[model samples]
Target: SFRFFQLDPDWISCLIDGAFSVGRVTAADAAADQKLHQKHVAGKQPPVVSGFLLRSYAVKGWPKLQVDGYKQTAQDEADMDGYKLKILRLAHLSPNVLLCLFEGDAVAVDIHQKPEMLHLGFEIPDTKTPDNYSKNLRKADGTDKDNYKNPWAIESIQPDPATRVVKVSQLFLDIEKKAALNFTAPFTSAQFALSMVEGVQKVRFVRSGS
Candidate 1:
């Protein structure tokens, strides 16, 4: 099996100059995926949905010239100070998807001839565990300081296969000094209808109340 990776111009130059070599490394946590191992044993291949690039640079001390493992030396600890960029595979889309909802007998929603507001969607974390994002950081020194946190967002929403019950865990909304409002019943029970609106796909969740 072969995989393709998009590289930067500097990396391309290094490859041409015979100064580039590749090494294989897997995350310590992800390597323990029992499901992935079971599939491998059964001669089944997993689909690759995306690829990530971790680019790291020095912040203070020079990079240590040694092998990386579960163990770390003093220089390895000190050299961990650096910045990293997560390069994600992205594609261009025009007339992006949006969500809208309406209820009751008749509700008039108008789209004018003026420019529409552009929306940027962020991918929410699927799991509450910080193990997934450990490699994304420049310093994977195994410390709480390097752990990822999403204070004002939904950590995960798991739907039970045996029942209609859906569980939402670690959801936070920071209103900052404003009175907190709760919509626990309707928000969880609200059903969304997804359809094409003006040639753009949308997921509309009609509100039960204001």
Candidate 2:
């Protein structure tokens, strides 16, 4: 029998990074199948989707919520801040994939156009636990606000199998919003799909309203 005791830092890093990417962290893990398969995360540890670029999806269990556009009728206008991007709850939760949903009213939705819009998306955090975010804030002195810049945004999250800690790396975004997302929230869910409008619906819901 041969025993190996050495660990390759580069290989381990790459392997974890790949797991996070393919895993799609930040998304919900509450689905029956996904939870059984991928929900083994300990504590607040959500599985990381991607690690290389600091972007990953965290999975959780949430109701079949509706991202009500309030009848945008138009597209571009719904992706802006002034736009009404609201999440309406449908019913009980189900085994579904919850991606980061963006909020847009009407004006912003109208302003955004296609082709370029496809290059935008949003980054939503799977969980909004204050401890998960605030615990990381503050310094030893507990008085240096300037030195600290760890603000909270709706980004994906991950859990370390080894350490069992969930963390947010980067906000989800299309290639275009990648740079801007670092400082702000990603685009709304509808905006993200329209930007990539393929099989996605113009206005959508995570799960069918039951």
The global C-alpha lDDT for each of the candidates, from Candidate 1 onward, is 0.24, 0.31
Off by over 4 Å in 2: 1-60, 69-72, 78-210
What is the C-alpha lDDT profile of model 2 across 19-47, one tens digit per residue? 65565645463244345444553243322
Candidate 2 global TM-score: 0.16
Error of 2 at 29 (Å): 56
Clash statistics: count for each candidate = 0, 38
Using lDDT as the measure, the top candidate is: 2
Q: Could you tell me how far off, in angstroms, the CA of residue 194 lies in candidate 1 after the best superposition?
A: 16
Mind giving the per-residue lDDT tens digits that candidate 1 earns over 28-126? Answer: 434444344445532332221122122223211212211111111123534422211122222212223112211111111122221232221223334
Off-target runs (Cα >4 Å) in candidate 1 are: 1-149, 164-210
